[model samples]
Target: MLKKSDMIAMALGVVLGAAATVPAFAAGGGGDPPPPPTCAKGQVYSAKKNACVKAERGALPDEEMTQYAYALAKQDRFQEALNMLDLLENPNTPKALNYRGFATRKLGHTEEGISYYLKSVALDPNYAQVREYLGEAYVIQGKLDLANSQLATIKTICGTGCEEYEDLARAIEDSKL
Candidate 1:
Protein backbone atom coordinates (compact mmCIF):
# COMPACT_ATOMS: atom_id res chain seq x y z
CA MET A 1 0.00 0.00 0.00
CA LEU A 2 1.26 3.43 -0.82
CA LYS A 3 1.77 5.56 2.26
CA LYS A 4 -0.59 8.51 2.67
CA SER A 5 2.37 10.87 2.51
CA ASP A 6 3.55 9.30 -0.76
CA MET A 7 0.13 9.89 -2.24
CA ILE A 8 0.25 13.47 -1.02
CA ALA A 9 3.59 13.97 -2.78
CA MET A 10 2.05 12.58 -5.96
CA ALA A 11 -0.90 14.93 -5.62
CA LEU A 12 1.58 17.77 -5.33
CA GLY A 13 3.07 16.51 -8.66
CA VAL A 14 6.54 16.36 -7.17
CA VAL A 15 7.69 12.78 -7.71
CA LEU A 16 5.37 9.84 -7.91
CA GLY A 17 8.21 7.78 -9.44
CA ALA A 18 7.38 4.33 -10.80
CA ALA A 19 5.40 3.45 -7.69
CA ALA A 20 2.36 5.26 -9.09
CA THR A 21 1.65 2.05 -11.00
CA VAL A 22 0.22 0.74 -7.72
CA PRO A 23 -3.17 2.00 -8.91
CA ALA A 24 -5.39 4.59 -7.29
CA PHE A 25 -8.03 2.05 -6.25
CA ALA A 26 -5.20 0.25 -4.47
CA ALA A 27 -5.51 3.02 -1.95
CA GLY A 28 -8.47 1.02 -0.62
CA GLY A 29 -10.99 3.82 -0.92
CA GLY A 30 -8.98 6.35 0.98
CA GLY A 31 -10.99 9.50 1.51
CA ASP A 32 -10.78 12.50 -0.77
CA PRO A 33 -7.46 14.40 -0.88
CA PRO A 34 -8.22 16.89 1.86
CA PRO A 35 -10.90 19.52 1.43
CA PRO A 36 -10.00 22.77 -0.36
CA PRO A 37 -8.14 24.08 2.65
CA THR A 38 -10.36 26.35 4.75
CA CYS A 39 -7.39 28.19 6.24
CA ALA A 40 -8.08 28.18 9.95
CA LYS A 41 -10.70 30.54 11.30
CA GLY A 42 -9.61 33.88 9.86
CA GLN A 43 -6.77 33.41 7.39
CA VAL A 44 -6.82 32.79 3.63
CA TYR A 45 -4.61 30.63 1.41
CA SER A 46 -1.55 32.26 -0.02
CA ALA A 47 0.28 30.77 -3.00
CA LYS A 48 3.34 32.88 -2.19
CA LYS A 49 3.57 31.54 1.34
CA ASN A 50 1.58 28.42 0.42
CA ALA A 51 -0.16 28.88 3.75
CA CYS A 52 -2.77 31.30 4.96
CA VAL A 53 -2.70 34.99 5.57
CA LYS A 54 -5.31 37.57 6.57
CA ALA A 55 -8.24 37.23 4.20
CA GLU A 56 -8.58 39.89 1.56
CA ARG A 57 -12.01 40.80 0.24
CA GLY A 58 -13.21 40.40 -3.37
CA ALA A 59 -12.12 37.63 -5.73
CA LEU A 60 -9.11 35.51 -4.82
CA PRO A 61 -5.83 36.75 -6.19
CA ASP A 62 -4.71 34.90 -9.33
CA GLU A 63 -1.88 33.10 -7.55
CA GLU A 64 -4.18 31.44 -5.01
CA MET A 65 -6.71 30.51 -7.69
CA THR A 66 -3.93 28.92 -9.74
CA GLN A 67 -2.89 26.85 -6.73
CA TYR A 68 -6.50 25.81 -6.27
CA ALA A 69 -6.68 24.81 -9.93
CA TYR A 70 -3.57 22.65 -9.46
CA ALA A 71 -5.21 20.93 -6.49
CA LEU A 72 -8.23 20.23 -8.63
CA ALA A 73 -6.03 18.85 -11.40
CA LYS A 74 -4.22 16.61 -8.91
CA GLN A 75 -7.55 14.98 -8.16
CA ASP A 76 -7.93 14.41 -11.94
CA ARG A 77 -10.45 17.21 -12.19
CA PHE A 78 -8.92 18.65 -15.36
CA GLN A 79 -11.95 20.37 -16.78
CA GLU A 80 -12.83 22.08 -13.53
CA ALA A 81 -9.22 23.23 -13.25
CA LEU A 82 -9.38 24.65 -16.79
CA ASN A 83 -12.66 26.37 -15.96
CA MET A 84 -11.02 28.03 -12.98
CA LEU A 85 -8.11 29.03 -15.18
CA ASP A 86 -10.40 30.67 -17.69
CA LEU A 87 -11.91 32.81 -14.95
CA LEU A 88 -8.55 34.12 -13.80
CA GLU A 89 -7.92 37.83 -14.48
CA ASN A 90 -4.57 37.13 -16.11
CA PRO A 91 -5.13 33.82 -17.73
CA ASN A 92 -1.93 34.16 -19.73
CA THR A 93 0.37 34.40 -16.76
CA PRO A 94 3.16 31.81 -16.76
CA LYS A 95 1.80 29.92 -13.76
CA ALA A 96 -1.70 29.85 -15.17
CA LEU A 97 -0.33 28.65 -18.48
CA ASN A 98 1.58 25.89 -16.69
CA TYR A 99 -1.60 24.62 -15.00
CA ARG A 100 -3.45 24.82 -18.27
CA GLY A 101 -0.70 22.77 -19.87
CA PHE A 102 -0.86 20.24 -17.04
CA ALA A 103 -4.60 19.79 -17.37
CA THR A 104 -4.44 19.72 -21.14
CA ARG A 105 -1.67 17.14 -21.19
CA LYS A 106 -3.46 14.93 -18.69
CA LEU A 107 -6.55 15.12 -20.89
CA GLY A 108 -4.46 13.67 -23.77
CA HIS A 109 -4.00 16.79 -25.83
CA THR A 110 -0.24 16.30 -26.18
CA GLU A 111 0.73 18.79 -28.84
CA GLU A 112 -1.50 21.52 -27.45
CA GLY A 113 -0.22 20.84 -23.98
CA ILE A 114 3.40 21.23 -25.11
CA SER A 115 2.49 24.53 -26.67
CA TYR A 116 1.17 25.83 -23.39
CA TYR A 117 4.19 24.60 -21.48
CA LEU A 118 6.49 26.17 -24.03
CA LYS A 119 4.68 29.45 -23.64
CA SER A 120 5.07 29.36 -19.89
CA VAL A 121 8.77 28.50 -20.08
CA ALA A 122 9.34 31.22 -22.63
CA LEU A 123 7.79 33.68 -20.25
CA ASP A 124 10.13 32.70 -17.42
CA PRO A 125 13.20 30.64 -18.20
CA ASN A 126 13.90 29.93 -14.53
CA TYR A 127 10.48 28.34 -13.80
CA ALA A 128 11.73 24.95 -12.62
CA GLN A 129 8.27 23.54 -11.95
CA VAL A 130 7.22 24.25 -15.48
CA ARG A 131 10.45 22.75 -16.73
CA GLU A 132 9.92 19.55 -14.76
CA TYR A 133 6.38 19.16 -16.07
CA LEU A 134 7.44 20.03 -19.57
CA GLY A 135 10.14 17.40 -19.30
CA GLU A 136 7.56 14.85 -18.27
CA ALA A 137 5.52 15.72 -21.31
CA TYR A 138 8.53 15.27 -23.53
CA VAL A 139 9.14 11.87 -22.01
CA ILE A 140 5.56 10.87 -22.66
CA GLN A 141 6.06 11.84 -26.28
CA GLY A 142 9.17 9.63 -26.42
CA LYS A 143 11.37 12.62 -27.07
CA LEU A 144 14.26 11.54 -24.91
CA ASP A 145 16.64 14.18 -26.20
CA LEU A 146 14.19 16.96 -25.55
CA ALA A 147 13.43 15.58 -22.12
CA ASN A 148 17.14 15.51 -21.32
CA SER A 149 17.38 19.14 -22.34
CA GLN A 150 14.63 19.98 -19.90
CA LEU A 151 16.41 18.09 -17.15
CA ALA A 152 19.53 20.09 -17.89
CA THR A 153 17.51 23.28 -17.80
CA ILE A 154 16.07 22.30 -14.43
CA LYS A 155 19.56 21.51 -13.16
CA THR A 156 20.71 24.93 -14.28
CA ILE A 157 17.79 26.64 -12.62
CA CYS A 158 17.63 24.68 -9.38
CA GLY A 159 20.88 22.70 -9.23
CA THR A 160 21.09 18.90 -8.98
CA GLY A 161 19.74 18.68 -5.42
CA CYS A 162 16.43 20.47 -5.92
CA GLU A 163 13.24 18.45 -5.94
CA GLU A 164 12.45 19.67 -9.43
CA TYR A 165 15.78 18.42 -10.72
CA GLU A 166 15.51 15.09 -8.95
CA ASP A 167 11.92 14.42 -9.95
CA LEU A 168 12.46 15.25 -13.61
CA ALA A 169 15.65 13.26 -13.67
CA ARG A 170 13.81 10.29 -12.19
CA ALA A 171 11.09 10.66 -14.79
CA ILE A 172 13.65 10.62 -17.57
CA GLU A 173 15.27 7.53 -16.07
CA ASP A 174 11.96 5.82 -15.50
CA SER A 175 10.95 6.39 -19.08
CA LYS A 176 13.74 4.08 -20.18
CA LEU A 177 12.80 1.26 -17.83
Candidate 2:
Protein backbone atom coordinates (compact mmCIF):
# COMPACT_ATOMS: atom_id res chain seq x y z
CA MET A 1 0.00 0.00 0.00
CA LEU A 2 1.16 3.55 -0.61
CA LYS A 3 2.25 5.54 2.38
CA LYS A 4 -0.43 7.85 3.73
CA SER A 5 1.29 10.93 2.41
CA ASP A 6 1.69 9.35 -0.98
CA MET A 7 -1.94 8.30 -0.84
CA ILE A 8 -3.01 11.87 -0.20
CA ALA A 9 -0.89 13.12 -3.05
CA MET A 10 -2.01 10.31 -5.30
CA ALA A 11 -5.63 10.85 -4.45
CA LEU A 12 -5.26 14.50 -5.34
CA GLY A 13 -3.49 13.61 -8.54
CA VAL A 14 -6.25 11.24 -9.51
CA VAL A 15 -8.83 13.88 -8.71
CA LEU A 16 -7.07 16.46 -10.84
CA GLY A 17 -6.67 14.06 -13.70
CA ALA A 18 -10.29 13.08 -13.54
CA ALA A 19 -11.53 16.62 -13.04
CA ALA A 20 -12.23 17.10 -16.70
CA THR A 21 -15.25 14.85 -16.30
CA VAL A 22 -16.27 16.13 -12.90
CA PRO A 23 -19.73 17.57 -13.51
CA ALA A 24 -19.85 19.85 -10.50
CA PHE A 25 -17.61 22.32 -12.29
CA ALA A 26 -19.68 22.03 -15.44
CA ALA A 27 -22.58 23.72 -13.69
CA GLY A 28 -20.46 26.88 -13.67
CA GLY A 29 -19.69 28.42 -17.03
CA GLY A 30 -16.96 30.55 -18.61
CA GLY A 31 -17.32 32.49 -21.85
CA ASP A 32 -13.74 33.61 -22.50
CA PRO A 33 -12.61 33.51 -26.13
CA PRO A 34 -9.82 31.08 -26.83
CA PRO A 35 -6.34 32.36 -27.54
CA PRO A 36 -5.15 32.68 -31.13
CA PRO A 37 -4.46 29.41 -32.92
CA THR A 38 -0.68 29.60 -32.78
CA CYS A 39 1.62 29.21 -29.79
CA ALA A 40 -1.00 30.11 -27.24
CA LYS A 41 -3.16 27.06 -27.78
CA GLY A 42 -2.51 24.13 -25.42
CA GLN A 43 0.83 25.56 -24.28
CA VAL A 44 1.53 25.35 -20.55
CA TYR A 45 3.66 27.58 -18.34
CA SER A 46 6.67 25.78 -16.91
CA ALA A 47 8.38 27.91 -14.28
CA LYS A 48 10.85 25.25 -13.26
CA LYS A 49 12.01 24.70 -16.84
CA ASN A 50 11.46 28.36 -17.60
CA ALA A 51 9.97 27.45 -20.93
CA CYS A 52 6.72 26.99 -22.83
CA VAL A 53 6.11 24.59 -25.71
CA LYS A 54 3.40 24.74 -28.29
CA ALA A 55 0.92 21.90 -28.30
CA GLU A 56 -2.10 20.93 -30.38
CA ARG A 57 -4.78 23.50 -30.91
CA GLY A 58 -8.30 23.56 -32.26
CA ALA A 59 -11.69 25.10 -31.71
CA LEU A 60 -11.99 23.75 -28.21
CA PRO A 61 -14.71 25.31 -26.05
CA ASP A 62 -13.92 27.34 -22.95
CA GLU A 63 -14.72 24.38 -20.70
CA GLU A 64 -12.37 22.09 -22.64
CA MET A 65 -9.64 24.67 -22.41
CA THR A 66 -10.01 24.73 -18.65
CA GLN A 67 -10.10 20.95 -18.54
CA TYR A 68 -6.98 20.83 -20.67
CA ALA A 69 -5.24 23.12 -18.25
CA TYR A 70 -6.26 20.93 -15.34
CA ALA A 71 -4.91 17.89 -17.20
CA LEU A 72 -1.57 19.61 -17.72
CA ALA A 73 -1.47 20.40 -14.03
CA LYS A 74 -2.09 16.73 -13.24
CA GLN A 75 1.05 15.86 -15.13
CA ASP A 76 3.06 18.40 -13.12
CA ARG A 77 3.19 20.81 -16.04
CA PHE A 78 1.89 23.65 -13.92
CA GLN A 79 3.21 26.56 -15.92
CA GLU A 80 1.41 25.13 -18.91
CA ALA A 81 -1.73 24.93 -16.80
CA LEU A 82 -1.22 28.62 -16.11
CA ASN A 83 -0.86 29.34 -19.80
CA MET A 84 -4.02 27.42 -20.61
CA LEU A 85 -5.92 29.13 -17.79
CA ASP A 86 -5.03 32.54 -19.20
CA LEU A 87 -7.05 31.83 -22.31
CA LEU A 88 -10.20 31.49 -20.23
CA GLU A 89 -12.56 34.48 -20.40
CA ASN A 90 -13.95 33.95 -16.96
CA PRO A 91 -10.69 33.57 -15.16
CA ASN A 92 -12.27 34.72 -11.96
CA THR A 93 -14.90 32.01 -12.10
CA PRO A 94 -14.69 29.79 -9.07
CA LYS A 95 -13.76 26.66 -11.07
CA ALA A 96 -11.14 28.48 -13.07
CA LEU A 97 -9.73 30.04 -9.96
CA ASN A 98 -9.63 26.66 -8.29
CA TYR A 99 -7.56 25.14 -11.10
CA ARG A 100 -5.33 28.20 -11.13
CA GLY A 101 -4.75 27.69 -7.45
CA PHE A 102 -3.95 24.02 -8.06
CA ALA A 103 -1.32 24.83 -10.68
CA THR A 104 0.17 27.63 -8.59
CA ARG A 105 0.68 25.50 -5.50
CA LYS A 106 1.90 22.51 -7.47
CA LEU A 107 4.69 24.75 -8.78
CA GLY A 108 5.82 25.75 -5.26
CA HIS A 109 4.20 29.17 -5.14
CA THR A 110 2.25 28.26 -2.04
CA GLU A 111 1.10 31.73 -1.06
CA GLU A 112 0.01 32.55 -4.58
CA GLY A 113 -1.89 29.29 -4.76
CA ILE A 114 -3.58 30.02 -1.47
CA SER A 115 -4.61 33.41 -2.79
CA TYR A 116 -6.26 31.80 -5.77
CA TYR A 117 -7.97 29.22 -3.59
CA LEU A 118 -9.20 31.92 -1.24
CA LYS A 119 -10.59 33.84 -4.17
CA SER A 120 -12.35 30.73 -5.38
CA VAL A 121 -13.88 30.10 -1.99
CA ALA A 122 -14.93 33.71 -1.73
CA LEU A 123 -16.68 33.46 -5.07
CA ASP A 124 -18.57 30.37 -3.91
CA PRO A 125 -18.59 29.47 -0.25
CA ASN A 126 -20.12 26.10 -1.16
CA TYR A 127 -16.93 25.07 -3.00
CA ALA A 128 -15.90 22.10 -0.93
CA GLN A 129 -13.01 21.04 -3.14
CA VAL A 130 -11.41 24.45 -2.99
CA ARG A 131 -11.77 24.49 0.76
CA GLU A 132 -10.20 21.06 0.94
CA TYR A 133 -7.33 22.17 -1.24
CA LEU A 134 -6.88 25.36 0.73
CA GLY A 135 -6.72 23.21 3.82
CA GLU A 136 -4.10 20.95 2.27
CA ALA A 137 -2.12 24.00 1.26
CA TYR A 138 -2.20 25.15 4.84
CA VAL A 139 -0.93 21.80 5.94
CA ILE A 140 1.96 22.06 3.53
CA GLN A 141 2.76 25.41 5.10
CA GLY A 142 2.74 23.90 8.58
CA LYS A 143 -0.45 25.66 9.63
CA LEU A 144 -2.46 22.83 11.09
CA ASP A 145 -4.88 25.08 12.91
CA LEU A 146 -5.78 26.96 9.79
CA ALA A 147 -6.20 23.71 7.93
CA ASN A 148 -8.44 22.43 10.65
CA SER A 149 -10.56 25.50 10.31
CA GLN A 150 -10.90 24.81 6.61
CA LEU A 151 -11.79 21.23 7.43
CA ALA A 152 -14.50 22.52 9.71
CA THR A 153 -15.83 24.69 6.91
CA ILE A 154 -15.85 21.75 4.54
CA LYS A 155 -17.62 19.64 7.10
CA THR A 156 -20.30 22.27 7.30
CA ILE A 157 -20.56 22.38 3.53
CA CYS A 158 -20.54 18.65 2.72
CA GLY A 159 -20.87 16.91 6.00
CA THR A 160 -18.27 14.34 7.16
CA GLY A 161 -18.41 11.67 4.45
CA CYS A 162 -17.99 13.66 1.27
CA GLU A 163 -14.76 13.55 -0.67
CA GLU A 164 -13.66 17.03 0.35
CA TYR A 165 -14.33 16.42 4.01
CA GLU A 166 -12.66 13.02 3.94
CA ASP A 167 -9.63 14.24 2.03
CA LEU A 168 -8.98 17.16 4.32
CA ALA A 169 -9.60 15.00 7.35
CA ARG A 170 -7.12 12.42 6.06
CA ALA A 171 -4.54 15.08 5.40
CA ILE A 172 -4.96 16.39 8.88
CA GLU A 173 -4.73 12.93 10.34
CA ASP A 174 -1.63 12.17 8.33
CA SER A 175 -0.03 15.40 9.42
CA LYS A 176 -0.35 14.37 13.03
CA LEU A 177 1.46 11.09 12.51
TM-score, one value per model: 0.68, 0.67
lDDT of each: 0.79, 0.78
Q: Cα deviation in Å at residue 120, candidate 2?
A: 0.6
Residue 168 error, candidate 1, Å: 1.0
Model 2 misplaced stretches (Cα beyond 4 Å): 1-58
lDDT per residue for candidate 1 within 3-24, as digits (tens), equals 9998898777744644574565
Q: How accurate is candidate 2 locally (lDDT)?
A: 0.78
Tens digits of lDDT, candidate 2, 1-177: 789999999999999888965564443422333322223445643333445544434335466667668767767778888877887766788878999999999989999999999999999999888999899999999999999999999889879977789889999899999
Candidate 2, residue 27: how far the Cα is off, in Å? 19
lDDT for 109 in candidate 1 is 94
Best by TM-score: 1
